[model samples]
Target: MAGDYVRLAAYTGIRRGHLLRLTHHDVKDGFLRLDRTSKTRTLQLVPLHPKVLSVAQRLPLGISDDGVRASWKTAREACGLEHVRWHDLRHTCASWLVQAGVSLHTVSEVLGHSSLAMTRRYAHLAPEHLADAINKLT
Candidate 1:
């Protein structure tokens, strides 16, 4: 269950609180409708990654915050990844999207970030895109 939660979070970039609040009804039309988010408290529709489509189907993840914390702690200790926080999974998603050449604007939308500035932190991950744009000027 915790593994599924991690996968869903990593794939969709949804916050832990928002993910916990999700229900089966939230999954529809190839998107996960987040009625409210912790940071912005606004509605967002995050597209479901094909890899996590099966995992998203089992919504209302059924794990309490404490349960997730415990599992994360155990997993981190076992794997010597104690420095990694659960929120890092969200960062991982953003980094992957940026590295894959997805535009910051699109990634910002996908992450439901209130501003594009919030997504800029991942821009450095795709320096090649910047270079490509510079090359186009030639």
Candidate 2:
């Protein structure tokens, strides 16, 4: 149950702070509404995948930011993933999305990035897209 929050962060790309503040009520109509965010201070709605929604719907989702730290650490150790941090989940989400052919512009929006510059870090994962773009010009 404790680890669910961490997984939610990964699946949704919501930061730790905003994720901690998320309530079940915020998850309505297949979307997660972030009424407050660290970066923009504006309400942002991120579409929730059905798997993410299922796990989220069952939990209270009100755990403190530090509440899941010990569980997260334990989970990492069990998986021999001691090098990973919770924040890395966001990077994983973006990376997965980019690899799956989702556009950087859409990924940036989903991650609530202020600009495409921040999302560009995942650009390298989509070399095929670049090649396609270059081929299209010919």
Top-lDDT structure, candidate number: 1
Cα displacement (angstroms), candidate 2, residue 104, comes to 0.5
Per-residue C-alpha lDDT of model 1 across residues 54-90, encoded as one tens digit per residue: 8788887788989988998999999999999999999
Model 1, CA-based lDDT: 0.90
Cα miss at 98, model 2 (Å)?
Answer: 0.2
The deviation in Å at residue 129 for candidate 2 is 1.0
lDDT, candidate 2, 1-138, per-residue tens = 667887788889988777776777888898988875555798889988877888766656555556688788888999999999888999988998999999999999999888899999999998999789889985
What CA RMSD would you report for each candidate? 1.6, 1.8
Most TM-score-accurate candidate: 1
In model 2, which range of ten residues has the least summed lDDT? 58-67
